[model samples]
Target: MTVTQILAAPAAHTAGTAGPVRGRRRALRRALWGAQILIAAFLLFASALPKFAGQADAVETFTRIGWGQWFRYVTGTVEAAGAIGLVVPRLAGFAATALIGLLGGAVLTHLLVLDAAWALFPAALAAVCALVGWDRRAETRDLLRSVAGLPRR
Candidate 1:
């Protein structure tokens, strides 16, 4: 092949492959967003709302935990905030990381104070949050840098 044609071959190959790579990235991003939305919805409607509304089961659970009803409100508020944060593009990673911590506590509480088998739910949630946090590590780092008054990379 001519010198020009030889040098152009890799560029041509890359250009041809770029479309599929871009498409796959887009699909993966969409899937991640879908998972985030579903988790957020569950947190908001199924978990936080019940606590906020003073539902019987939530009240009973908090009572059993021996932290008083006020703790219930605090937990509900944190969950609600985390749920909202998961939907925010810039804050999703930080939110997910926070949720992982919260879920960790939940898992422990379930194992020690509540039903051991019930720990699985929070454990599963924490796993998903870990995935989200890892995927958005760049944004989380940028957020931390900004918080510390350092310039983002």
Candidate 2:
């Protein structure tokens, strides 16, 4: 009936048994975040590092793609950046979205230029990135809006 009561209604409604559900949701989110970080780290070390170092396999792969060694460094840099961004809470979704593109390129390279069998790894990584980005859609939207200098809703 009162202005104060009206304004406080929503908070009051959440002040009771909603605690357990909220706790569970928080736990689930934490678990998913942990998994996301682990995957990003794995990609950083397993794939990105070798590319940056110009390891034989990476050089050969890039050569097969007809892009030369320079492109290896570029892809490695992007992957490294994305991996770092993945650990930052505000940047996770954006990073995952970027990684999706990078990994998609890998997939295309495998399918078009290299052996199709080699495409599996990048395809899986891309799928995981897609899931991460979808799960953090709100964060992605916020980051995009901020980058575009648009007013937030």
Candidate 3:
């Protein structure tokens, strides 16, 4: 075969390999991230609804949560947003960033101004974010690479 044909053969083989490579990468990434997404979803649901009925500190809970019924709206929205964001290959890496930031602020609020018990909520979510960040370091690295405008170095 001609040199052109020889070069074309490798390109053609790579084109074929691309499909399986991407698929495996996607599955790996998804598996790593699925747990984090579930955690986010669960947190959103709980935060959206105060499960403890008629607890002694009902008013205090609402007050410390800092949004009353609006807390439901805000937490639900952010949690769901983060949940959805976790799936986007481009955004999943930083999904942990925004979420963990929120969780960190939450932990601080609990320590400083709210019930100590409330700290668990944010701490749990923060753990999820950290796990996601760690497991999907490659994806997060990809995200930061783009954000920093550097090549895939």
Candidate 4:
């Protein structure tokens, strides 16, 4: 075969690889985003559950946080809303924003007030948010463009 023929062969093969590479990237992106959503939902359920209703340790921990019953209700409500946003196609960008804020606050509370070793939950959540947000940047940007200046509900 000629030298030009060999060079052309690699270019053709690379072109073929492009589609598969893009597919894999897309799959990973979806997985990361789904994981973040699931984690948020789990946190919501755990934080909202009644103290001592099921587990003794959970009850003690809830009491230790000292957020009070009313605060628990508020956290649960917002978490539920965040979870809903995660699953809804139209609300992905909003969900990502909310999750980041929620996790950021958790980390701060742990460092400033709780001062507990178990504050890693929020830190991990924040990492997941960063990953999902990074993967979905283009999509989120398009969403923002679509919303333009619409008033929030």
Candidate 5:
């Protein structure tokens, strides 16, 4: 083979290979975004709304935990805000990370104060948030780096 042909071969092969890889990455990113939105929406409607509306169960649950009804409103606001943040592409990772913390608290509350079996729902939500956070680690890192005034890698 000619020297020029040999030199160009790998470049040609790589160019051909990159397209499918990029396509798959795009699809995976979209899927992760969808999952984040779904989980966030679930948190907003099922948990946050009830708490904000002063639903009996939410009130009772907080009362059972020995925290005041005020705490319920605060928690509801945080969850609602985080849910909205998750819908923003640039903030999704951060939002997911925050939700993971919120869910972690829920998990601990269930295991420590409430029925241990009740922890499963929060645990599952935390796992999903972790997944989304992991999938968006690059964006998360970039955001943190920017916040810290560090140069992007």
Candidate 6:
């Protein structure tokens, strides 16, 4: 092949591949957002609301935990905040990381204090949060650096 044609070949190939790569990234981003929304809704409506409203099952469960009704409120608030954070672009990574810890505690509580079967839900949620956290690690790092008064890496 001519020198000019050889030089142009890689550029053409790269340009051809770029469109598909960009499309795949966009699709993946949309899927992640969709998952985040669904999980956030579940946390807010199914988990947090019951605690805030003092639903019978929630009260009974917290009573069994021996942490008092006050602890229920605290847990509810955290869940609600995390749910809100998940939808906020800047806070999504941090929120997911926080939720992973919260969900980890939940998994332990279910295994130890509640039914072992109940641990599965939180474990699944934690896995999703881990995905989001991994995807947004760069943003998380930037946020932490800003909080620490360190310049961006």
Best by TM-score: 6
> Which regions in candidate 1 have their CA more than 4 angstroms from the true location?
1-21
Residue 42 local lDDT, model 2: 80
Per-residue lDDT tens digits for candidate 2, residues 30-143, read: 766887888778879988999988789989988888867899899888988998988898899889888999989989888898989989988987877776776676777888
Clashing residue pair totals per candidate (backbone < 3 A): 0, 0, 0, 0, 0, 0
TM-score-superior candidate, 1 or 5: 1
- Per-residue lDDT of model 5, residues 37-111, tens digit only: 888788799989999998999999999999899999999999999899889877888999999999999999999
Q: Which ranges of candidate 5 are over 4 A from the true structure?
A: 1-24
Ranking 2 against 5 by lDDT, winner: 5
Taken over the whole model, the C-alpha lDDT of each candidate is 0.86, 0.78, 0.63, 0.62, 0.81, 0.86
> Candidate 4 versus the native: TM-score?
0.65
For TM-score, candidate 2 versus 4, the one ahead is 2
> In terms of TM-score, how similar is model 1 to the real structure?
0.84
lDDT of 6 at 97: 97
TM-score of model 6 vs. true structure: 0.85
Superior candidate under TM-score, 2 versus 5: 5
Greater-lDDT candidate between 1 and 3: 1
**TM-score list, all predictions:** 0.84, 0.79, 0.56, 0.65, 0.80, 0.85
2 versus 4: better lDDT goes to: 2
What value of lDDT does candidate 1 attain over all alpha carbons? 0.86
What lDDT tens digits, residue by residue, belong to model 6 across residues 68-146? Answer: 9999999999999999999998889899999999999999999999999989999999999987877767678889999
Model 6: lDDT to the true structure: 0.86
Better of 4 and 5 by lDDT: 5
lDDT of 4 by residue, 92-115 (tens): 556767778877877777777776
**Candidate 5 structure lDDT:** 0.81
